[model samples]
Target: MNQTHLATLLAVLEEGSFDAAADVLGISPSAVSQRIKALESDIGRVLVRRSSPVVATESGEVLAQAARRMALLQAETDVALRRTIARVPLSIAINADSLATWFQPVFSEVAKWDNATLRLRIEDESRSMMLLRRGDCLGAITTEATAVQGCEVRHLGVLRYRAMASPALRDAYTDRTGTIDWAHMPTLRYGPNDKLQTNDLDGRLEGKPVNRRVSEIPSSEAFLEAARRGLGWALVAELQGRELVESGDLVLLDDIVSDVHLYWQYWRLESTMLHDLTAAVVTAAAEALD
Candidate 1:
């Protein structure tokens, strides 16, 4: 119920320790503990679980989210009144591929704002929405079109991918009859979370045994480079792979195109900064995605 206590709870969760949060808040560790205790007592529920690095309980998480939203709103109001306020970080989650390609423009847009800062958490598109549910980020670029509770959703567009490999790799896997030996060919995936490569190839096998010869390359640029250098075939984003395809560096393994429909999901708060960011993301997706 107390605004100060709520802020303290949010700070503890973000900083990961009571002492660390105390330093950020310019207060003693004792004061921080007292506030958290007062908050828990007021709510008649334990808000934070005392640990080496304190973690919020399920009920605590709900309050932490509310606290974070309140902080953002207060920061906005301070700026509107021409008061000097510390830069507020707008945390967002995005996939590695999107960061390297269509999402670049969003960074450029954020650079122009003086009152806000960007804190990015790179996760797979499929899992990025988890950050939203956990209140780890204010917004995310995700594969899920369905809105999370207290959030809004917008369909960006499809990011088309092509199954591609080096000419040598393709030739080595192709038989004299022109049928490709997909079951034996090596493949690359961004990481364990990345299913694009395996999903596409597995669909072709139709219950047959798969090669299981897969390499994990986590970085987006490195993943593309590995495929280009003949490490393995992979599903490459069209925007990132087009030049390589044209330059004869990478060849298409098949004509089937994978279309991943992307969406923008954010807290349904009436914040100008969030609105502006959504607009920027929508505009950039329009130009880069299908």
Candidate 2:
């Protein structure tokens, strides 16, 4: 396989268009298209779908991942040989809750490294595996225990969630018998991707879930803030909401807890940067997660 063609494929996928990729490569759009055509002819597979934002076909994904690994290894070699003063980019995906809690220490550790830099994609743990498959990120902190194809997986501990609400809101919705109004009380969610609050509610309620009053608060900080301000109740991460629960700012709705087991999935490559990062993540998770 031609290295130039592989690099062009990656550039098109990353930049989202042939023209954008051509500009980055300092070549004409026709030259970029010709290279892609030549590569497809050589491989006998349709590698790219030329849509509004160009996307990879199934076959393209395999080659794209190969190209990404080659680039990273080349970059690592360059840095190690002091051939260039460039920092090797270590791209990965992490969930919002983990980012707000245990993942903080990983940032501090990365800051001490001068030869590498981070390219983080903030995504939901349940859905980040797609990024890994597309080779958009080299690794991900995901809820999935099974490894993505061509990737290795390690079990990080579970992140526990507690359904919580403000004291005033809980009292306002509680009835005379002390049975909380699960059906009528408003609920907060991080986004459409978030299922923790809904799953918790459905398990506790009898028939027909709550009257579906939900407000979307996508940011981790704001999600907790909405619960604290009585906007709506939400399933908050234990590490993030423990102090609030202790301070009487938020109260648990029930004793039931939602435990999401997390895992680290990364390309099975022998690279020092990845090794150091995995060590840092495992160490932090051991201390923070149950």
Candidate 3:
């Protein structure tokens, strides 16, 4: 209910610490603390989790979103009233594949909004929703069909991932019978957080999952490089590897593939900018995804 204090809380959660929030607000750290304390007293609830990098308690997130939504609405009003609004900063979360493939339209759309400036955070599609839920981002491209509460989810398109390896690896590994021992081979992983290979393996090998965990090369480009150098087979996004596959550099391992259906989730706030940007992003994705 208190807009000023609510904005303070949003800043702390966004900046990830009280001192950082103070730097953004041009206020003393003690002042930031006093505002948060006053806000907690007024709301009768603990708002921030006092960690090295501060985090919002569950109710704190709701208040933070409320403040963000109000800011968006205010910006829209200012524009409509023929008033000058400096850059309106909007943060959105996106996965790597989408960023690499269909993001040109997002740039075009944002550029049309003279006052809207964009900051992008990259996370795995499975995890990007967490950033949106925390108010770190207002929208997300994610692999979730169900919307996070207070956000609207739209099915954009399916991003197809293929199990691939270098031609040399496949030649040495796949026999005349086209059979390969997947369990014993080295595997490439995007990161410890990545489970695409595990998910693919689990789907392929019925009872005995290989329990195969290998490399943790998180860079998408480097993952392809490792695959090219025969480090291991990997599930690469179709967009990222289609050229290599066509050029006979990366061999398509098998018919087995992973098609992750991506969804666009955004705050349900009635902001014209969000609506326009969402439409632009979804339209662009349709051009690339199935």
Identify the leading candidate in terms of TM-score.
Answer: 2
Over the stretch 133-226, how does candidate 1's per-residue lDDT look in tens digits? 9887889999999999999999999999999999999999999998888888899999888877778877988869854789999999999999
In candidate 2 the C-alpha lDDT for residue 242 amounts to 97
| Local error of candidate 3 at residue 84 (angstroms) | 4.4
User: For model 2, where is the 10-residue window of minimal lDDT?
Assistant: 203-212
Q: List the residue pairs that clash in candidate 2.
A: none
How would you encode candidate 3's per-residue C-alpha lDDT over 1-290 as one tens digit per residue? 67788889988988999999999999999999999999999999999999978988998887887788887887778778868665567788987667877666779878878788898997888889888887778899998889998899999988899899898877776668879877666778777667666777666666575667488786777888899888988888888899988988898988867889999999988888888888988899888889
Cα lDDT listed for each candidate: 0.90, 0.90, 0.84
TM-score of candidate 2 against the unseen true structure: 0.92
Question: What lDDT is obtained when candidate 1 is compared to the true structure?
Answer: 0.90
- Candidate 3 segments exceeding 4 Å error: 82-84, 209-213
